[model samples]
Target: MQRNGPIALAFHSLVVVFMLAPMVVVCLVAFTPENTLAMPWNGLSLRWFKAVFHHADFMSSFGNSVRLALLSATISTVFAVPAALAITRYDFRGREALNALFLSPLIIPHLVLGVAFLRLFSLMGMGGSFGWLVATHAIVVTPYTLRLILASLTSMDRNAENAARTLGAAEWTVFRRITMPLMLPGVSGGWLLAFINSFDELTMSIFVTSPSTVTLPVRMYMYASESIDPMMAAVSTLMIALATITMIILDRLFGLDRLLVGKG
Candidate 1:
């Protein structure tokens, strides 16, 4: 393997710092003793963090985001598995078209999707409904799950499946015992990625979400527009902490290198 030289290493370190600087600044600002969104240079205080918990709107928005992420991620995973199996295991007319349809969201901008969904929901008289919001998010995140499941299915060895069938195992049994297990890593990784995306989603959500179903990002955006305070910084800090904790849990349970990069 080629090792990075000192210059290359320095450049990469700078890139990492650049990417992380904003988040680091936000977190630090969250600890500020000042009322404004400034760094905690004089001293640190938990006032903003406490305020976030006590704030009804933020808490309600947080709950909505969690439910949305969970439902959308699970729904997408359930659909992606069957769709991936059909695409990878069968050869049929329009097979390529079906695959492209499943992946088209990756190419289409979210802004367009939000507008399309908004119009569709209005026509169906389902505007601002939590159920419809979840459905739209599921559609948006399905491509991520589908791609991961497809990669898992394609890279999987079929010998075990063949052997099981030859041994008189039912097709369903073979799939349940062999195929599902083999693709579990992909399924899990895809679900996590989908959940994260759905949780952090903003543009599409802003259009689809109603007053009652407002998500955290949407709420944060509204708050930022109305005020400039350490409370927004506090909210951002909490989100960053949530993401960090999730990554730590995933790394501990599955090893990030294995789950993310397919390297054990």
Candidate 2:
């Protein structure tokens, strides 16, 4: 057992290295000095980042992405919380099926879903608009919010609400004051997940975006398709940084660990 331990350790280390190697290469190449992609040995510079800023369209796309992410995340969470509460707090016919449908998006392919939405929007006379994009994004991110809120609601005890009701508290009061505070962690976590989902969405956005409604991911896709540039990597790196900052802010505001499987 001891003799094989070193081999196992080395193998796992190799696996990790393999996974990280591409990211390391991307970071290095983003700083390449040459017009075309090259290695650091030739020289390294922040010229690509400057190009990304000077492009101006990149900033527009970034702003659009932020707006879309925030709007979709908030709207999705709003719908998902009520949906989760209804499923968990109230018994009803077809509850199981409803829950399944809410979660089905996670299993469905985004590309296929995007195509379906494009058709649906066309039929409804709402294709290729910000409204359509927001609705589609909300649907895509709904599963994340639903799952988190459902888990949180199930883990939370209803004894407090029952006690409050027995003491003459109204249903709305119990829900808002007691249940909501307890479920805040899951709700916040759901919002974070939804934000990330909408912010980084690609395939769906590609099908639905109009010229004016284009998001950063769609813009990046267009740029990468038309011209393979290091600016793609720079934009991606900025997105990662922003996502990290958002996560930190959310975790600080709401207990990140509590929403999963544990009590705070």
Tell me, by TM-score, which candidate is best.
1
lDDT for each candidate structure = 0.89, 0.85
TM-score of each: 0.92, 0.88
lDDT string, candidate 2, 1-264, tens digits:
999999999999999999978777778888888777666677778888888888888889888888898999999899989999989878999999998988898999999998999888899898778877888899899988877788788888889999999999998999899999998878888899899989999988988888888899889989988987778777776777777787786677555675444334
Q: After superposition, how far is residue 148 of candidate 2 from its true place, in Å?
A: 1.1
- Candidate 1: the clashing residue pairs are none
Task: Put down candidate 1 lDDT per residue, 7-45, tens digits, no spaces.
Answer: 798899999999999999999999999988788999999
Q: Which residue pairs of candidate 2 clash?
A: none
Off by over 4 Å in 2: 1-8, 42-44, 246-264
Candidate 2 steric clashes: 0
